[model samples]
Target chain A: MANEVESTPNSYPMNGGIGCHSYVKNSHIQRALLHAAKDVITEAIVEKVDITNPWFNSSRTLRVADFGCSVGPNTFVVVQNIIEALELLYRSKRHNPEIPEFHVFFNDHVHNDFNTLFRSLPFSHRYFAAGVPGSFHDRLFPKSTLHIIHSSYALHWLSQVPTQLADRNSPAWNKGRIHGLGASSKEVREAFSAQFSKDLQAFLNARALELVGGGLMLLLVSGLPNEFHSSQTNSAIVLDLLGSCLIDMAKMGIISEDNVDSFNLSIYRTCPGELEAFIEKNGHFKIEKMEELINPVRWDPPDFQMLASHLRATFEGALEEHFGNEIMDELFERFTNKIGENSHIIYDQQYIKETEIFVSLKHRVTDYEV
Target chain B: MANEVESTPNSYPMNGGIGCHSYVKNSHIQRALLHAAKDVITEAIVEKVDITNPWFNSSRTLRVADFGCSVGPNTFVVVQNIIEALELLYRSKRHNPEIPEFHVFFNDHVHNDFNTLFRSLPFSHRYFAAGVPGSFHDRLFPKSTLHIIHSSYALHWLSQVPTQLADRNSPAWNKGRIHGLGASSKEVREAFSAQFSKDLQAFLNARALELVGGGLMLLLVSGLPNEFHSSQTNSAIVLDLLGSCLIDMAKMGIISEDNVDSFNLSIYRTCPGELEAFIEKNGHFKIEKMEELINPVRWDPPDFQMLASHLRATFEGALEEHFGNEIMDELFERFTNKIGENSHIIYDQQYIKETEIFVSLKHRVTDYEV
Candidate 1:
């Protein structure tokens, strides 16, 4: 698998679908909210999901999956939270022990290691459990089987970057590529919007087919509203800082300008109201409850040491692939020095919140005919 | 003159001190702080004072004063915030030029209003200025010659109500004082702390003789340091809402307990750190800068409207008092029914920052040589 993945010299195309740790790192906030969500879901959807009468053969068996299960503290938190809620739900049904039990599944991409997920699981899973691997975009689960689906900090990536993005001759696609710049130029803004809408619908379509009747789907994703505009000065500051670092690396002949130009990373953003409406439009599911968390999505303060370490990590992954490890220390020190002077607030203003977290629940009102 | 002043009927004392409307009613936050102090002094001070300042060398010129000046706002804000360093102090000096010109005395009572003071006046006075009003226990200036020594929100009938407070051992003093409960009782907490010190220093001795330096002591006054000791549960809240109306006539037997106590008034609280320290040390000064103003100090969501209104004029003076009257309806509704239920932040939690504005400069630095 490693050879196959590495054989593709310009594997950047396949990387479009490869979920980055940035998204995974973004899921940490969901952990803090899981406890509060227990009551909210109970009052809003749990009691409404009536599984009374065993003979009626309702969709009594629950399969809860954390779909883009990230590594580290967040994944553990979500898994534990789901189990806690399910246990409470089970205890509530003590009068009728005949109630069907819950089955848990944790799924992620092919690149995600199952060993880590396996080690993190609790020993006591009274209800059944499984670890599914493969992209949700592809066929990863059985048809119409999932009862409750939750994917926090995922689903923003397109199945693949539009081919026309690199094709300069195709005016429409080239325009779409340019529009993804810092959220200024309305045309570029609209370009990202159109692509996001198309990709989001595809995501919804895939989940719609997998969810059983009366299943709940909870999703948390990142986005910036159209109203948000990065001030020219702030953007300039970040660009200058990053530009200097890239220039120094270029002088060292580590990474070529051509590689930087050809690189196309997906930056996804969606409005809360628009996303909610998008889910509602998908006929297979009914919107049971939707709420936008007021706090920022990726807002967390990084300490000075963490800042230095983050620079080192970035270099290790992409930079070290091109440049030998010898220049690693110099490159990291230069980056940190620039950050310390120009972007001191990236560390000092760490306490200021700037991320948004949203939770949405979807229940299967109808089975997929196809 | 002293006996005549003492004999002048108690009509002024019970007449709510000053008319709610006569003072400037449209003051902004800065102005409201000074104005409210004017009222706090009128109602709380026991004697009529010459409110002016006397120059040290040329005894004819007026001396100005401010207690708890804490380096005057401008420079200190920079030291604390680091962002907009010295900008606050620079702006304050530019606006209130009077701070540096007169024989201006800066006082902090002990805990020091240094943040506000330092940020207010940065450089040395172009004309002449000094720091004098120390602790209200010892005299800061001489007798009967003050031209104008301004202290806003400084005097509030002492910390705990005077020691002789409930000693109705003399019926005249005890009458209807909280059902025989002395202000210094365990239930009242620091209520008598100020009065105990004041009586030992001969009841307002500090500022009594310091006026030999000035004439017009413009004072800003009001009940302040809204501390609560379980017994005073929601006293500020009750006064702001229900008590203002009923308590007025309740004392006259116009309303019964069923009608009066049933209504709760909202109370606003301030820290005792400023006034408590000043009273304990007993620094004396001429009462010059005296005027009541309201600067509504509150929290996010503005849970207490009535309290905000009552405190609004404390700093910004009559200007804000008028402004508050206009929005009284919506403000009261929001405070009573909507505050806790909906957390729509109406004001920053640090709203009404300078609760009561007191400005009194010292004519003498310490007790006279006699």
Candidate 2:
């Protein structure tokens, strides 16, 4: 069953429940990203959103969706921020006493723990909440229905791993490595880059059809600086270390060498230039604001256990499917020990630079009818 | 946590996951109710739905909601039926080449197992599906947003148990019983009846606000006949037998007597007259169709174990909360034995008369704005 589910391109769900290894417990990094982007999101909504839009006037409801919204606390916090900003816009800016009803959709993969999400919903939320389960690369909502779309720290997940990465005959075959970044071959990096472009195009196209004209889409993405090599990022270093650990396991006969060779992480961090090129090519949405965000929560002394747990929470589903569940404990333990050994790398300012990009896009007014 | 959740009223979620005692595995009776209502639902949509209504043409999307949708194969079945009927209406009757997109919201209490519902969704379903977790007695959608609302075998679950049944000094104190029907005191029955009326009113009032003018609301309810005594129904007799088993356990010191006295089921079966009266008083909806449905599935020679399992699945959550989990296996064992001992009651044709009510209501076109 796990293999069958994994064969499907978009089935990598985060660890469910609130256990120690669950995403709910280990999502501090994503939460910090949300905190960094909150002000930017609020500012964009207040400045760029058209309060006099006819759709809002007619429907008397504002529909918002958070794509790739995993189990909450962070999703809930971001949604609350959006609602508060909109309410302020209605009351303070427009001076409209009648605020439209807020209907928010929290979306993720079919295997996401929506039971946990629903159970942990804020008791006194101002908006009606609904959980939408589907790949966001496909259309999840009806045409011209959503007024706001927000995705935070989730766009990095490509729809699937690049097929070339696993084909032995292909130049892009990422043998003995599980990721395309860091010390991966140039061909492998290009393959991942191409896949990211395709996935982003699909995501943008789908959102274009779903969003109303003048709708705002706010995205907080883990990204790379345009001038810096992908290998220089903190995440790339982490993935490289993880891949080395897997290779070590294979050498020790804990896992098969062939399994290690075939396994590839379906994640891609886009640079600002790549995002701009795609949005321009799509032509349906105009970039309203694009800027690098500074994360407020800095780890002065890195917590290696927490970092290891975080990675485990995010990648356990995919890893378990690739190498089987028996190797999980040992694999993560080795990765943690390796992290401790290489702890000095974290102090290398040049190699450990992390980039978070915040982009606000508006659906262009179009004559196309639903 | 169990006590606090139960105390909030509306937190009785069906046993989650696909275990043998889960609602998903034991929902055959509810599935039968849906099958019996399918034809009536399709016919109502064909005859009464206004295809050329401004709402459908303007939005180019039909929003339908199923209130009290449990984790299901049944909810999926019913939603498919509704969508198929709408497609037929658009294609065959109206001769319209353009059929609106379908967006369905499946709703239950906050505690419903939405994860299971989402994972088991029909893979090739035509509609965009969402799970709305909240009580139907409250407003779940924006005003005038829904074009169709359907609930099957779910309206019987009241928002909460009647408080009067637990008050020792009150005339309605239901001592040594778990339900209001079948030899329960007259005061207890009246209290249940009043609670049902209040809950039904809330359901109707909320739907009236959410549904668009000229929208359709279809309901398939487990009910009693107008002139028949509640104590005579098969379910009432079954409840009586189950209550006897609980009292026997209490006598043997297996459970506290006070716990049994305070444990009244929140379910209420409304007769056709009661439904009509509530609709008449509410006045926002016009009854288009009202009739009793004949269930097609019949248990030949009565499978006592299957019957016991079904009852256990439905009531285990409540029972476990009132009395701890340690007694579950023994409680069900005794209940099954008691059912086997009183198997003669199943053959009493008059007492075994089960009533399934099918109701179709049309939202009255009003000048009220959203």
Candidate 3:
């Protein structure tokens, strides 16, 4: 394959196809998050989107995009909700002209299973669908083309693991950890935060260039509260346990400790304050709405198997790439066992306190001089 | 899998991925045709396209689409040629302003392997890339969005097989054959032609809706001369032999005869006269250039194995859907053997006289009365 500008250095496509381990089959929690955010999304569009703009009447089409859309059942649901909400807005305005036709773009990294996504598109969807294969942190569409951009649970994925985390001499060197949380040093944690800030800026800047003036962006990201430590989140706890399982395999001579030391997941949990500050600094978009969504799922006693499957579906590709494909079953088995041993910590109210941030932003027309 | 209006009734996606049997490896002939038409395409754009239109200055972007773009190395080549030619035109015109950015859409059936296509995109190409997943015989884009549309060796694929060919009692009932060529009755051939005409009209009408006024369309199709019979071409000879191979299997009791009777390849080869008539009847596009391309490949003894592989790459999916997967190996083996037996006919000058038609058309601004 030719070197492609669209190919991100660390593209982590969720497991593709409809297999038991695929994202489509294992994204129940994400689906729950989408369902939980539906009303907020609808309300945001109704409140902030300027459907009466002359642009809408003249274009005769509404262009919407879902960024970081993996091979989906959830992304489909997200786009449909957006379209329905837009339709509601059009109806409420009582403008006699026919509702504009919908043209939706499903965007993700080049390696994302667009084939499966395309195949799984809802046949009766009123929208014309196109799959955009590129990193959202880069410009993926022509300027002023997109009207609504939606991304859910995807902003956490940084472009790449921060370079300093793997350097042996750097203060941020994360020698024995797979992420910048749960026993990671303050320097390592700050490195992750800095990377997140940079990634978010790139995302916002690129989107600002692509979106039409007054266009709306609905972002759903998993994050911690301002006062909460990164280590308190359920994801950090599970991932820490996963890292321990990798260590156990190393001790058992099943895999190398060096491989474990070099591998760090490229994900970050941003706080609302940090996100707001970054967006303010960027200044291309106005923060229309930002709220933490309520927890949509409660797993009493925790379904360890289901959790394992979900984690596998989301990270199997990345894990396999780093650790080799042979150790997946044993490694996940050990991770599940470790999760069982530490079930109390996972179920504790303090540990399960991660929040999903729902943000609505409007493209700042004044900021775009052209 | 909800009922999608975008889904064509009889979509035939070429064999995807980069495996031995994939279209990527076997599309040398298509590549040759693309190369053969490059000069003509460049000349047509330079001669016929009005780059000075106010729309180009205001939009600052050009949108081009390649329909029926199978998972490709060839499609990439085609898009590159177009971009380069457009750049040449821009430089020659000395417009002073920076050339408008190119946004290219690679369109094929929803079943096409867009993942592979996206991954194979040129890294340094100066264009934004997108994959539109749906049948070309339907509306795939918003009205007046596309500036240039290209389809090569794809318009021959009908939306579906003619219904009468399988009616058993109809005059067009094509038993013991898989196509309306070579010993098939005139009624069968006429049925195939009618289906092609209908499908072509649908393609034209949809494209007419999507293409901006004064948009250019470059089309390359395999065709026979107006005076020639469908059975006189190289493709027809090979297909007729393939049909005989199926009948041979039926006689050997390896596969049921009824399956063969029910199956007809949903493909038609149009002549220049027929294509011109259809375009004129449609009345949306003005024909700019229509000429037969010079043959780029000459197989001295005819590379039967290569021909077999190429045919397999193109038809394996449709064949598997019609005949059970179990018979694929035996079916192709028999096909190869039959090709060997009829090598003389395939190599004969008269039979190998199939011409590739390259068409350049401009969307008629006056005709599209908005």
DockQ list for all candidates = 0.00, 0.51, 0.58
lDDT of 2 by residue, A1-370 (tens): 0123223755789999999999999999888878878889999999988776776555588999999899987999999999999998888765547988899999999889998898788877888889999888888898889999999989899888888877899998888778877644788878888888888888899899899878899998888888678787777778888989999888898888888888988988888888888789988899998998877564445889988999999999999988889889998999999888887785467675667889999988754333
TM-score, predicted candidate 1 vs. hidden true structure: 0.41
Report the lDDT tens digits of candidate 2 across residue range B168-285. 9999888877887654578877888888888888889889888987889999888888877888887888887888888898999988788888888889888899888988898989
Candidate scoring better on TM-score of 1 and 3? 3
The list of candidate 3 runs beyond 4 A from truth reads: A1-9, A52-57, A298-301, A367-370, B1-9, B182-184, B298-301, B367-370
Give the distance in Å from residue B306's predicted Cα in candidate 3 to where it truly belongs: 1.0
lDDT of 1 by residue, A1-370 (tens): 0122222222111111114323233334455555445555455434544444221144345667777664434655665566566556666766755445555566655434443344334434354434444455544444455666777656654444445555555443432122243545454456666666766776677777566655567776654443444322232244345446756666678766544443344444565666766666665566666565544322245343344453343223344444445766676677667776765544334323223335555545534231
lDDT per residue as tens, model 3, A276-348: 9989999998999899987658444389988988999999988999888999999899988888899998888
* lDDT accuracy of residue A198 in candidate 1: 69
Candidate 3 lDDT by residue in tens digits, B163-208: 8987999988888888775535888888888988988898899998
TM-scores of chain B alone in all candidate structures, in the order given: 0.37, 0.95, 0.95
Greater-DockQ candidate between 1 and 2: 2
Write down the RMSD of candidate 1 (Cα, Å). Answer: 29.1
- Candidate 1 chain B, run of 10 with poorest lDDT: B8-17
